[model samples]
Target: MNISTFGLGYVGGVTAACLAKGSHNVIGVDVKGEKVEMINQGKAPFYEKDLDNLISQAVEENRLKATKDVKEAVENSEISLICVGTPSNPDGSLNLDYVKKVCEDIGTALKYKNEFHVVVIRSTILPGSTENVLIPILEKASEKKSSGDFGVCVNPEFMREGQAIYDFFNPERIVIGETDKRSGDHVAQIYNDIHATVIRTDIKTAEMVKYVDNTFHAIKVTFANEIGSVCKRLGIDAHEIMNIFCMDKKLNLSPYYFKPGFAFGGSCLTKDLSALLSKAGELKLSCPLLEAIIPSNQEHIDKVVELIISQNKRRIGVFGLSFKSGTSDTRESPVILAINRLYEKGYAKLFEKGYEISVFDPNLDKSDMENLPSNIVPLLSPSLEEVVEKSEVLVIANNDKDFKRIPSLMREGQVLIDLVKVIEADEVKDGEYIGVCW
Candidate 1:
């Protein structure tokens, strides 16, 4: 591939040198005359590990060169890679001035170039930026329809600063997002000999993947720091704790709680979190992340109450009233909060004289009956059929085996408000199959 790399920064210079060493004819372009002269003289413009020798060798072999003229670079190369910087603004938004200016230059260069040239953006950008912003700029400046007269692709780079040369040669994955199949295929051929997973996706998803990887990295760093702070205050070794925590790959660091659904509430989680928060307060150490956990949990409970209020139905049936399934402990149960709010709001009443408000739980203990509200009824239905016949809105709060059978017993007009998501049944057709957090 005849390649022209723009913006002779860390990523650009290293990539041009490596590709040139791999026998690709490369032209490196930049606005700085000093950098161009340095690269032309068989010297690396930027400092990187093992990059100087590679650049010197590529330039000496006549496979790589540098220039300031964008037109000359575009005219000689078959594909151009944009590696410009996206600095941050004062208001925390991204400043894409460098990207916009380079796009304009490339577009203008394409206006006179007769051959179909591929423009690949290797700059890190937010989602929808390539299609929403860059494509329109290219279309306006080139005076040609993209993918018809030329090709465009976004190939995001994932290189560390000091180890860029190593990362360029050995990447975890290569993502190529193209405007057309020809552009995608042409861009992919450059990595024909590389030993990495090649993923071809749409432009927006490709653009977002870079940000997601970086943001998740930042979050992990902060989380570890927070744990370290708490451990240091308590005279405990944080690294040893984390090492043991990470060893449980199934739940601790894996996809155990990665789902986007309802809030969590159980005897152990709620009790442990409250104790840790109280300990943080006694030490007078401000742990914002730790402090926010209990409130965030409370917010989920409040949301369930609000959703029940939004239904506007007077008659409600709640199944599985305990904190969770297979337990009779009602302390801090989220469903109790929902039921209390409904009773206070005048929308809920006790079971009518003959029309019993049906409830079922395979694990509810008679000793825990004191936790029930004074006004609510406690008619324990042994079977789901009797429960389905009594209430208009069914709230499944637990994952009991009996609750799973309630969906099979569901009538047409009854609404199912699932908090634990046990049944695969629709409540009031499609509109009322409400999951508490789904």
Candidate 2:
């Protein structure tokens, strides 16, 4: 593919050389005359590992060249890769001035171009930035519709500064968020020679992937440092402890607890985290990330309660009362905490304003009960039909096998709230469905 790479900074420079090395005709675009001159002279404008030699090779082979004119580059190439910087603003937001300028220049260049072009955004940006901001700018400037006259794709780069060249060829994953299948296909073909996981998703999701990867990296670094602080206070080797901790990849370093859903509850997580924070507090160590865990978890539960309250339904049916599915233990169950808050404290308040919660936990169903249950235990329905019959709002708190049919069982006006994603959006035939985090 003929590629025009805009922005000749760290990411752009390395990308141009590497792509050209992979047997693509790369035309490097930049606003800086010095950078353009350096690239055309087969010299790296900035410092990067192995960049100078690769650029030297690519330029000498006539596969790579640099130009200051955006029009010339865009007109010559089939796909234009926007590799401009999205630096941070003073208020902690992204400053996309460089990206916006490149988009405007490309849009103007596209106005005169006759061939179908795919504009791939390789800069790191927040979700919705590509679709909401850049696409509109292209449309306005080019006087052409995106995904029609031209195509758009957000292809975020994951190159570390020093190891950029190595990371490019041996990427863990390649994300191509495209407006159309044709655009995605074109972008994916760019990496056909590389052995990496290629993920094709919507434009917004692809844009968000970069931010999530970076944020998680920041979290991991802070978490390690905080543990190091705590270990230093206890006269323990932090490196050894972390190495041992990381060795349990099945639970510690794996995707065991990374799902985007309800607050974490259960005996182990809450208990262990609390103990660690308490010990850290005794040493007067301020671990903000560790400190925020409990409150952040509580806030998630509070949001669930708030969602239930927002439904304005008096009769509420809760499916699976335990912290998770297949568990009989109710110790520190988040759903139980949510239910406890729903009940009225006094007799005066009980009759005034409170929800009627009917729970149907397969593990907690007392078939031997002859009488009604208490306010704490709530109404434990013997059958799923009984809970479905009595409640106006049904909340699925866990992933019990019995709750799988709840979406299909929803009545006309009832609201089915799913915290564990047990029910699909299209499964609910009658009532409105809502996912807690989703």
Candidate 3:
């Protein structure tokens, strides 16, 4: 495959060398004469582990070349990979000037080209950047429609600095966000021999994957450091603790609590986080991320309250009472907090003229009913159908299998505030349904 890489910086240089090593004809395009000259002379513009040798080998073998001419590069190559830098602005947003300029140059070069060219953005960008910014520029400049006249994709690079060559060849996953199937297949061909999982998705999801990966990595680092800080104050070995913690692959280092749903609320999570934050406070150590956990949870509860309040309905039905499904425990339950707020706002007044709140949970019996607020009417409904029939709005608070039947039982005007997304979006009308944290 003929490939052209824009911007001969770290990402581009490494990508070009690696692709050329894979036997793809790679042409590196750069504005700087020195960088272009260096690549042409079988020398790497920057130093990276095994990168210089790879570039020198590829150039010497006539599999790689460098030039300042975008037109020539575009004319010769079937695919162009944009590897330009998107540095941070003062306000913390991405500065996409380099990316935009390179796109324009590529688009202009595509004007005279008769063959279909695939433009893959290997640069790190925000979610909608590819479709909202790059595609429009390419279409206007080339006077061609994407997925028709040309192909476009957002194939984010996962290469780490200093270990660029290793990371390139041994990527954990290859993500291809394409405008069309042809574009995706073309991009996927570059990794045909590489042993990695190939994920083909929409352009926006592909763009956001890079940010999500990087931000999660940052969070992991800060989390470990905060734990270390608290451990050091108590003369405990944080490494030993983390080693054990990570050993629990079933829960700790797995996708156990990673789902996007309601705020975490159980006997352990809320209590443990509070204890950790308090210990950090006692040590006079500031752990912003750790400290913000509980407050962020409170905000999630508040958001549910606000969503319910926005409906302006008086009669409300809550499907579950426990902190989670299959349990009767209400200690630190987010649903309970939301219910409390609703009662305070006169949305839970049972016998009053303003509101009526009815709740039904298989786990909640007469004894459990005694602990709830006086305003919350615990319905002795033999079936969930009875509760759904009476309430104007239904809130699915837990991931119980019983609540999954609610979507099928939904009435015409009834609204569902779903914290656990058991109901499919396509199953209900758009305005009549709301996902709490989706």
* Ranking according to TM-score, highest score first: 2, 3, 1
lDDT of 2 at 429: 91
lDDT at residue 416 of model 1 (Cα atoms):
84
Q: Determine which window of 10 residues in candidate 2 has minimal summed lDDT.
A: 365-374
Tens digits of lDDT, candidate 1, 1-438? 899999999889988998998869899999999999999999998789998999999999999999999999999999999999999999999988899899999999999999998989999887778888988898899998889888989999999989888898899999999889999998998888678999998888788889988987887787778778889999999999889888998897787776544566667888897788778788887777767887887787778777766766555677887777778876777777666665565554433432324667667666667766654436566656767777777878877877766666666676788876675544244235777665
Candidate 3 residues 1-438, lDDT tens each? Answer: 999999999999999999999869999999999999999999999989998899999999999999999999999999999998999999998999999999999999899999999999999999999899999999999988899999999999998889889999999999999999999999999998799999999999999999989999999999999899889899999999899889999998888888888888878998998888888888899999998888988988888998988888887888887889989887778887888887676664544576666777888776776666554544445568888988888998888988888878887889998888877777775338888866
Off by over 4 Å in 1: 297-438
Compute each candidate's TM-score over C-alphas: 0.75, 0.95, 0.94
Better of 1 and 3 by lDDT: 3
Show where candidate 3 strays beyond 4 Å: 346-352, 370-382, 429-431
lDDT of each: 0.81, 0.88, 0.89
Each candidate: RMSD to true structure? 5.3, 2.6, 2.2
lDDT of 2 by residue, 1-438 (tens): 899999999989999999999969999999899999999999999998999999999999999999999999999999999998888999999999999989999999999988999999999888888888999999999999999999999999999989999999999999999999999999999998999999999998998888899999999999999999999999999999999998998999899878777778878999999999999989999999999999999989888888988887788888887788887777778887887666533222433565477888888645423222345463677788889889998899888888888877777999999998888889999989999987
Q: Compared to the true structure, candidate 3 yields what TM-score?
A: 0.94
For candidate 2, the C-alpha RMSD (Å) to the true structure equals 2.6
**For model 2, what is the alpha-carbon lDDT of residue 221?**
98
| lDDT of model number 1 | 0.81
1 or 2: which has the higher TM-score? 2
